[model samples]
Target: MTAHRAKGLQWRLVVVAGVQEGLWPDLRRRGSLLEPDRIGRDGLAEPLTPGAMLAEERRLFYVAATRAADRLVVTAVKTAAEDGDQPSRFLTELGVEPRDVAARPRRPLSVSALVAELRATTVDPAATPALREAAAERLAALAALRDDDGVPLVPAAHPHRWWGLYEPTRGEVPLRDRDRPVALSGSALHQLATTCSLQWFLGREVRAEPPATAAQGFGNVVHVLADEVASGGTPADLSVLLERLDSVWDSLAFDAPWKSRQERENARAALERFLRWHVMERDLGRETAATEHDFDVTLEAGGHRVRVRGSMDRVERGPDGRAYVVDFKTGRNKPTAAEVERHPQLAVYQIAVREGALDGVEGFTGRPEPGGAELVQLRIGAPKREGGDELPAVQRQPALSSYDGDGEWVGELLADAAGRVLDERFTPSPGRHCDTCSFRGACSARPEGRHVVE
Candidate 1:
């Protein structure tokens, strides 16, 4: 059993293997942050000290060994030939009697067969001569150790079969520099000033997030339903909406059965609320003209033209001939009016629609003149009314707004943010969001001339 999962677990015969010098306690490396704790200039607590780390590792191993109901057998390799393979000092510290046991051949402990298997899969059998020689040496050493008392060695194979046998980039495969503007999305650029530019750079260049949770998944399904309904193909009946919602829900692959059921019920309630909202919009002479409209808008930022791109969830035409941009939020965590007033996304979209960003289209002969933006929030829960029956209520809480037509804030904000990015200085601005940041493990808020250097 692995050490992590073996905690508080006991067996009639408990054998703790691989108690070697380089492992077990696995002491901290020489240059590691383990000398004395020091807070870095970034205000992030940078701790140090190998002694404390070793003590903690020892405590865990000690607990694992002591969790024996009947007998405890601690074993290590005593490879006299290999310089580093020595018994763990913890066994000697316990004053346990030394006893040599013969090695037993097992299905999982095949060293020669592993090399053969890898060679068979390789494109060229003779390419991995170094790997084969190393495998041979390990097998010979294990054969010598079989005559002595030590832990039986097992070959922990590499995760990939063709790890060492491959050609580096050749021919037409040319690596490209990441800095060249595959320009960052509008949403990405907007978030840079709010968080740190470093966070955005890390996410764009290094790694991406995994599939979202159930709530997010359900929200995406609702987005698709909204798109379909806005396209004017589907009839706006409750049964029709539910049927489409159920079909979309069924199309999604949910790993958890209970989450699927729960999200479905929640999505149904949200869709019902959305249908009611749609009726009100129609009554107010608002007609959805666009759904999932993609746009690439160029704006003056930092004395140069920078391209910003994103998709609008919905665009509607009012009876007064004014056009509106609408975005849907399935969760109740709607931004306040103050927050929305200065929000980059709304401001940018407002300027884009005003500047004929989505002008030429196949839908109609006319173009949209910016009215403003709205965030439609869908509720799947029913909050109780004061001094009333406990009946459930589904509702759409919308935040509708209109711009005064003074659209210069969009240019100023974008110019400042884009200038900082183009300057190539990425600094971490720590705040409440840092706690939930996925890149928090590697986040260091050190001073200038440190990681902030491009």
Candidate 2:
């Protein structure tokens, strides 16, 4: 069976009846068997290797086991001829215990007993009311169908032709070619499904907003700084920086030049503050704490792990076993605390840390610290006003307060938030905040404005 068949199906107990040497991690399998070759003079004559076939089987087994909702049981029976039979090498590798069931007698099954068992387990408690209603309507429609043999059928079709039956035909074709086959990579199908689901959930078409010219200009400045830092250059010069600010303002395409100037100045100030947090104060720290060789930090709430391969600005470890998650702000203006709280990306990170999903990060410092960490915001901008201190006006502030001391409370909050996520209960809180949201135009709850989409 294909992995797609397992979608949306869950079981409390799963039994993998067979796991043998040639079945589990089929080590004899090679990769070439699955590769498609163009038709040649000899049609359908592509060579297949034993290794490739075995590898494919192994992958199928992996897919099958991952589909188990909770508990998984793998069984392998041994026969007398193979009395000293070693369990599947893959099972040995995975450290699974294989029980010899041949010594026990098999149980018999009756038709009524089997029917009762199916009835007991077929009901789904987790199905939503809407889903139940839709299923009932579908069943009713199916029940209305009559077969040529005068026998009721459940609309069954060959598994290979299922897609064609479900999808609309592009054109009329004879029965022989009715099931026009189309190839789709697993990854491609997954991405397509994800995109379709997102569009359905949003109830509208979705497209990424092109970055503003102003934002792009500032991004160039950041690109230059990043290059210099990579080359071991110190952050002391302001010439390229000033030019960067000027470029950003010039590219604003704003109706009012003064308004652009104000926005550029505000953004520059934020960037400067951010630079201080990274360079001057060195408040951010980076260390590889886990075998994952990524950013993991231990906290009082639990352990927080973050993958910072390309997107990290600066990572700092605090004395109290807290991690200061910092991301650079090149965009104009800063989001408010309420906006941050509503953002799922940040909320998920908080939840991940609280759940101890990051093993290396949890209690790494061997101290109790807040599970809810702080988010530091640094605004980069021009040097402080001439008469005032050189420090930028928009200094760093913790976007999230510490929840380290109250792990239990944080856990409760995360549990509630997780439930909301599972139930898809997100609601947009639009206001002035929409001015900066990339999704503003398409969001249903976005404030009415000239920029809003109908």
Best candidate per lDDT, number? 1
Residue 370 C-alpha lDDT in model 1: 69
Q: Could you tell me the TM-score of candidate 1?
A: 0.54
Task: Please report the candidate that would top TM-score against the real structure.
Answer: 1
Per model, how many backbone clashes are there? 2, 23
Candidate 1: residue 119 lDDT (0-100) = 38
3-116 per-residue lDDT for model 2 (tens digits): 447645667776666666544655552436654563468776555566776666666767667778788887775556664444565565445665566555332344334332
State every prediction's TM-score relative to the real structure: 0.54, 0.34
1-454: candidate 1 lDDT, tens digit per residue? 6777888777887888888776877875534455433446776464436877688778878878877889888888786576768887777766677676557543344565654454344435665777766655654454444325564454334323223345533436322223443344556766775667777766665556555666677788888887877787777776988887776676677778887897777777777767777776788888887889888866665474656788888887777776677777787455656666666776667677765666875443476566777666665233445212121232222222322235555667676666656665567888666765666655555432232121
Regions more than 4 Å wrong, model 2:
1-205, 208-213, 216-236, 240-272, 275-280, 283-312, 319-322, 330-428, 435-454
Instruction: Candidate 1: list runs displaced more than 4 Å.
Output: 1-184, 250-255, 361-367, 380-405, 445-454
Q: How high is the lDDT of residue 428 in model 1?
A: 81
- Local distance difference test, per candidate? 0.65, 0.44
